[model samples]
Target: MTILNSQHILKNLQELKSFWQDFLPHLNDRCILLMSGDVGAGKTTSVQMIAGELGMRDVQSPSFAIHLRYENAEGKAMDHLDLYRLKDDDDLESSGFWDLFAQKNSLIIIEWANRLDFDYLPLNWQRIEVRFEKLSDTERKITTRQV
Candidate 1:
């Protein structure tokens, strides 16, 4: 389901979080969430919310670490990857992200995902685009491409 041109992101966020909790139970493992948005578009904020919902206390951007693997109280690990520093395709190639894809039961949220080529994406991924609009600080347009 794709949400296009939303006026209120906080409301949309409530819905998005609900969508995850309501449907994610059936998946029984990890899922890739490709957040296609520019800086300050709430991608990191959304992921932080997810981490909290998953029972994690801290959620920080791994801009320097490249990736940060967080574990739930139940031992489930969520991998958060930041591609903001990657200058070229070769940087992505060196990341060996494909091997990381093999890790099941782990959620991967990629920042600056649009910077990477589609060929590197997993077969199953939820693409989310957030566009800021209007003078209102809280309004945004979000489009989701779910496969």
Candidate 2:
């Protein structure tokens, strides 16, 4: 397994785009990107930025819909999921969350992933930990880790 712990400070959207560009080549269809952090830690923002960089325009939070799928700039399928409302495994099962894995060529990004039990998650997936550090009233830092 590749244990990666990389950090980047994103002060603006341009920096976020550059970071995604650098990380794009490392992503693949079988990867599930689990994002964990406190509320307002830029998890959705990160997803939106990555989606935008990958050519998904009009990206919005999937908190209400819980799941969304789109084609990236390369025409690759991308899945965005939110687990904030899931209360248990039965909820997940009923929601057909696991069914998403059946779809090929999916690069899934999940928000509020910390709410789920990690042991039940698919193995060999990438876990990204995002932490928002307040530097000032107008400035903040987005730290990311890949494991």
Each candidate's TM vs. the true structure? 0.74, 0.79
Error of 2 at 11 (Å): 2.5
- How high a TM-score does candidate 1 get? 0.74
User: Tens-digit lDDT track for model 1 on 3-51?
Assistant: 3222334445676576456534543365676666667767787778788
> What lDDT is obtained when candidate 2 is compared to the true structure?
0.70
Best by lDDT: 2
* lDDT for position 26 in model 2: 74
Model 2 alpha-carbon miss at residue 125, Å: 4.5
Query: Model 2 off-target regions past 4 Å?
Result: 1-4, 124-140
Against the true structure, candidate 2 reaches a TM-score of 0.79
Q: List where candidate 1 sits over 4 angstroms from the true fold.
A: 1-28, 124-135
Clashes of each: 0, 0
